[model samples]
Target: MPDIEIRQLKKDDVAAFKAIRLEALEMEPAAYASSVEEWVSLSDDEWASRLHMPVFVAFKSGEPVGVMGLLRQKASKMKHRSTLIMVYLRDSARGQGLAESLIDAVARFAAESGVLQIELNVSSENGRAIRFYERNGFRAIGLIPAGMIQDGAEVDEVIMARRLT
Candidate 1:
């Protein structure tokens, strides 16, 4: 294991955030709903605004290696839940426990914010990710057929959730 530091990304860290995030979007197109083209087109202010959310970034040797974000449900009826988003780990950083560290960071933040459950949707084709989530206490509750389409190819999505309370 390397000297890994997991911390919340701040507005001032836009450059570092963009670098790692753009890499994720490009490297794993099937893993994320957002595309590199869409994220790359964002203006500086747009990127800065996104940092306001609780986005946890993993840093190794002062460089970002993984990221995970939390989005709390805003509707009055769904206030106790949060959706985990934008999870990614660089190839060099995988299998070193950095991904789990990122998840733990988001889980702690979500629980602290009064969130009782955290949910996520992972591409069913991504077996490694599915296993990782299962190991982290998330259980598959449902599946959406043809949930995502990458390059005109349909992919199923697995819905998983973990309780914080």
Candidate 2:
């Protein structure tokens, strides 16, 4: 694979984002919040809202294959913390550290945005993702029992956090 480049998301790139997001939802249905088919139905405004969350996409030879976002909390008490969401990497982008680069960009963006902590919810069944978070200095903080409803099935979520100084 060629070198992957991680950059901020642009409004015009919503199509690419939708494509990879839908692929992630389809490929790992249990691990995502939305489905591929559902993403396709979302309006253009909904797709544009993604950029507000500090979105970033990874490109390999100009094709987007990885995406992640930092969503700031709305409540005042938790405003210091930003949620890390929508992290998805295509199969071709894996094993090349593209995901890690996306993550590194998230950390930078969070710091710049005045966020002190970055949190994410991961499925309990995805051990590889848990290990990846651990290797990147994230610690499991809590568990959300039956927090996710996927395909009429109840799935638990593991809360993990990484602090930014």
Candidate 3:
């Protein structure tokens, strides 16, 4: 694989972001809470607004191949925590260290921003993803029964967290 560059996505990246995001939703509908239909009709301004949070995209040869975002808690008492969300990598980008690198970038960013912990929720059936998060220092903290509904089926979600401080 060629060198992978990970960087913070800016407002100018709306087009690429929209393309990659839609692809993710299309390719793995069960993996995400949001549907392609929900985002496909969004205007440019609405898409750009989503990037107001810290979203990072991974690129190879200048083409986006992966994306992730860190959402900080807005409440005064919860500001020390952040949630890692919208994590997805192209099929071709898997099995490499790219995901780890993307996660490390988020952890570093969170620590720098005074966040003491980071959390994420993954489908319980996604063993691969659960293992990946565990390897990266996230521990299973709890489980939400029937946390999500996909294709008329109830799916359990495992909540994981890593202490940064």
What do the candidate models score in CA lDDT, each in turn? 0.92, 0.85, 0.92
Error of 3 at 76 (Å): 0.8
Q: What global local distance difference test value does model 3 have? A: 0.92
The digit string of per-residue lDDT tens for model 3 on 1-165 reads 577799889999998899888888888888898999999999999999999999988888888889899999999999999999988999898988998989998899889999999999999999999999999999999999998999899999999999997
- A best-first ranking of the candidates according to their lDDT comes to 3, 1, 2
Native-referenced Cα lDDT, model 2: 0.85
RMSD of 3: 1.0
Q: Give lDDT: candidate 2, residue 28.
A: 81
Q: Report the alpha-carbon TM-score of model 2 versus the true structure.
A: 0.92
Model 3 misplacement above 4 A:
none
Q: Please give the RMSD of candidate 2 to the true structure.
A: 1.6
Compared with the true structure, what per-residue lDDT tens digits does model 1 show for residues 1-165?
557799998999999889989999989988999899999989889999998788889999999988988888999999999999999999999878889888988998898899999999999999999999999999999999999998999999999999998
RMSD of each: 1.0, 1.6, 1.0
